[model samples]
Target: MPPPSPPPPSLSPDLHRVLSLLPRLASPRHLLQAHAYLLPRGGHRHARVASALLLASLRLPLRDHAAALVRRVHPSVSLRAAARLRGRGGGGLAAQLHSLLVRAGHAADPHASASLVQAYCSCGSVASARRVFDETAASADVVSWNVMIDGYVKSGDLARAREMFDVMPGRNVVSWTMVIGAYAQMKQPEEAIEVFRRMQVEGIEPDGVALLSVLSACGDLGVVDLGEWVHRFVLRRGLCQEIPLMNAIIDMYVKCGSVKKALEVFEGMEQKSIVTWTTMIAGFALHGLGSEAVELFRRMEKENVSPNDITFLAVLSVCSHVGLTDLGRWYFKTMVSQYKIKPRVEHYGCMIDLLGRAGCLMEARGLVQDMPFKANAAIWGALLAAARTHGDTELGEQALLHLIELEPHNSGNYILLSNIYAEQERWDAVRELRISMRDRGLRNVPGASSIDVDGMVHEFTSRDGSHPSLHKIREVLCAINSNIKSVGHIALLPESLHDVEEG
Candidate 1:
């Protein structure tokens, strides 16, 4: 090849300008010319420019160029590029690139070491990543610890991840945020909230991500006070401008059973995404605010915001809640006819529930028969619930058959059908159902209820008498029951003495 020409005089050697040029470099000669200028200016030490060059050179299918580029850049940049490029060649190529850094004595550099650990972790070689971490633990920084914790999380090893987190030399917002998220994903929301409390005690200011994780934990635990505190912090920090964080706040309030507070936040948001609209609609559905939900949905359309599948599901739920059968049917049809969106099983469930609850059992059963996908347990469960409510023993039996086949292990399905038979005074049929349950070794799962008291949640299960205040609670409940009974009130017992005696 002839001598490479110098970079064009018009091209500035500034980092940003060089980065802009990498994408536009069409030929090997242009790349060489740019590299010639950048190399003299120590631009290769900058991770952004080096990463761009590494990516550009690889796209050009110039192995020599990529290798030479990797060697010229800082070690941290090389390992980071290697980590990103792992998708192209997997662990084998990562090992090759890591060898190059080791040969250049760059493996001992703290940032570079962290990058190497991350590269191995990204490629799913957690063992190799751990080895590198152990070797450099003395010099490792917070970034190194964060990467290792993240790798363990990605690998689905939360126990070890938490262990590492606890033993970490120090913690930052990322560290606290990650552990909080990990616990949430593990369904340990209480632990997640506890960690958030510790984080607050440590005086580390939570960023948007940290706040999001904590909000999710609060929502899961129904800790509205902490959720409100997080909301205040967001406002105090001026991070409410982020639409996602605002969305999390709405979800937290909804889950905490504060629909009014949730709506207040919803109305206050200046900018909204489809998620915001859907969350608000679902919140209204949950709280049985059908009129408000419908109005908001119509306003959403007026603003030209397209509704997705989840949006229709929320609208259908609102209709179901308030018994707007006709309106529910219209939306269900419009979801497919106007928007060209396919109906998911959940949408069909909502529609079936609406029709069944409205005493349109025949129409609901027809929809189930005509739906495109196979009916799941939830679809049958809704039908069964409606049958029970409407005293349709025949429809209840049909729904029960499907429910049993779909969910043989679920005791709730069996109990629902039995209750329907008991309502109709079909003692023989109820006895047979009880016999079937006994033969299958399925016992009715106890029902449970919960109440929140001063930021603490208390849960009770049927037949459970374990609370410290159980005696006083029962006394109060007895007095209330006696007072109501005196006013000509009667309790409709779902499980009669005969049904209970059978088992």
Candidate 2:
């Protein structure tokens, strides 16, 4: 290739310094300073200066201004040259070039129109992009339609994206994937799966990207059968077990409550990324196989797979779930010493949870006090929960003090403190706390419980009468309560006594 052109002759030495940072601008702020310096000198007319600014601010909110600069400087710029620019990456560049072509009276040019649509979408101006698409509707190419759909998908305008998809005369693989991916991204996994089915009915086979998205939807919905079927299809299609596809498969199994299956995949993998190991470790932890998780970490070390912060988080969580206090502490030490992973707030919280559950309330409190980072509500909550378990009223009260200040509006904090008082038969104290809560218009967050009957889930909240069948529900519950009492079971439940005497 020919040597790149030199910086514009009209640019000064200081301005040239800023131009040199093109494609590597420090921040939006610096980009603005450069524009401020150049736009006044009319240097924006120079091809190099506009291209540089367009490149620097591609990810910034300066596209429109850059496009205007290009148009104002060269109203009759070359259409073919600008179209070629669109072939390169970046919506910002495409946008500026679109303006250049439009100024040259080529606004209706198919390539020009499509480039404008893509550029507006890239800059997050989805509405503006849609306007361009609509204006050229009769001549809009599939590329323009697909870009518009993808834009809406990325912008969280799922309804609009679906509308575009439904109206497309001809749908390509990209079109199908974008819409399906949008549903999954919006957490509407059920809708995503339905879209996948529709795509299959239309005889449009899914590529790797589409398949990965479908698997993600299955995982989110906890449909193991669908995930397994997809896995079999993947193998039959000879799809390479790339790192991302492998991770998604493992995640699907883990999320579907089949950690053993996830482990089987993990063990059989010839190549594993950090994400793969982390997924397996987290799966083991989730399934209460703490020892296996810890052992996996050891194996990871032997295999020279460096543990990132997430790995340590999973390992410590494994220890916490299984009450392996000494093991958790050892991993925390190993994290800092051997792995050089600095402890984040979550790591500290895990440690506190371990110490608190192990009846080391004092040590947990001391760690909270000595940690470099200020303890958050979760850390203090762990301490308080531990205190309640071990009947350390003093420490419990101490932790409660911090938790109350940290989460003043959280009704659980007040309710928990009241329970602590009730445990000691401090009825008067409990009543006082209830009164204070009532004064503050505070009510305990209702506990959620659910049951499945005839393959349909019914949910209810404690002390709530919102359900349509609540009256019937209460009757059934009371009968169950009577039966439990008949079985010699004594439930030590707290009484709900709130005096609503607001000050």
Candidate 3:
């Protein structure tokens, strides 16, 4: 249940007696009687009495009375009440308050204006919020602008948010943090890092939120040095006590390809949230340390920490990677039977993938049919990949059919099927498939990879010699390839079939 409203800001004993009576009133008729008594006593002019009356009217399901009463209440009280109402999904009531504010000649109150803007934003009426913001631009403060930027971000209009941020007269830590977090969430890590750098250059010491977003960007870019620096900063600032920051630190290490460091951080933590445990398990999954992941999960269970859906996902992924078929099956069943967690698409996808990788093609197909939901493209793609690996052309064709329907524009599905045909020396089938692809105007998308060097991200696309450091990069790759070959390294043939170099 919602918490009781904070006692309508400290009223006189007389006003308090009226406020007390407002909550006890049983119906709109009684509330209207109380309102009738208050107006003639000149109590309607007091902010507390006006607020109490408006709230009492609302509680009685008297929207018309509340809207009319809003016009008589103090502007600040109405806006404050509207902000609170926004949390309860009262967008319409908030709009009524806004209209009353304009009509009551209180639009010039800066604090009330900011609160109204925040209310509109929270209500998902961003366009309405923008209109209010424009009306008060001359009087708008940093808080007002920040609320609008936050509104645009919530509406998934990051471009507009960034545009507003660029033109802001001044920015605080919250402003910079919002943009940084937004960019990281949008998967634009480079932009996030760039803005972070700008924030630092301007002498803005980042708060915990800013640091968390920067660490996320650092992890995405695989910039371990920057992530480590953030970790040190967290330690220096005594922010490591915050579980969320610590969780982000571990995640950063995992994504930066530093599983050892991730484990070190995880082990050192005296307190761990479910997120902390899950992040460590996922870290082991990423590094293919399946045994370690299982051990850690057991430890978590022994400590009486309940595994969440994400925790199960992490463990199942570890099982998939290392071909622990029986273990995977047990975990999948236990997740549903014991934990009472309904399996989502990702869970089903992981199980199907685990089964496929273990050469249980028919059983995997059976699971797809038995699933509560229709098989998605990822499920079909996993089955097709496994079929190609095991030379089950019929199963591959079945997966291809569903994949084509689910994702008609995806050239990768067509290419996988063609590869399966080619592997079996069915040249006639391959030729027909190629003709179909050509007719459909489908071409294989280039594979891409990226690496971070000295804090800068460098991306490379298959067969693309566009980088300025192409010659040096080629020389380094050739040397590494030669060294690996000297140690008897052998490439996986089926995996190489789709490589641009092989084509």
- The clash numbers for all candidates, in the given order, read 0, 0, 0
TM-score for all predictions?
Answer: 0.76, 0.71, 0.84
Which digits, one per residue and each the tens of the lDDT, describe model 3 over residues 1-503? 11333344345677668878985789888988887877666676665667667766766678778767655455656765656655435667567677767666676688878888888888888888898899899889999999999999988899999999999988999999999999999999999999999998999999989998999999888988889989998889888789999999999999999998998999889999999999999999989999999999999999999999999999999999999999999999999999999999899999999999999988998999999998899999999999988989999999999998999889998888889999999999999988888898888897887899987899877667577887676566666667767788863332322332332
Instruction: Give the per-residue lDDT digits (tens) of candidate 1, residues 344-398.
Output: 9999999999998999999999999999999999999999999999998888888
Of candidate 2, the 10-residue stretch with the lowest lDDT total is: 494-503
Q: What does each candidate score in C-alpha RMSD?
A: 6.6, 8.2, 5.5
Evaluate all candidate structures by whole-model CA lDDT and list the values in order: 0.83, 0.76, 0.85
Q: In model 1, how large is the Cα lDDT of residue 187?
A: 81
Which model is ahead, 2 or 3, in terms of TM-score?
3
Cα error, residue 294 of model 2, in Å, equals 1.6
Scanning candidate 1 in windows of ten residues, the lowest lDDT window is 494-503
Task: Return the number of clashes found in candidate 2.
Answer: 0
After TM-score superposition, what is the CA distance of residue 494 in candidate 3 from its true location, in Å? 14
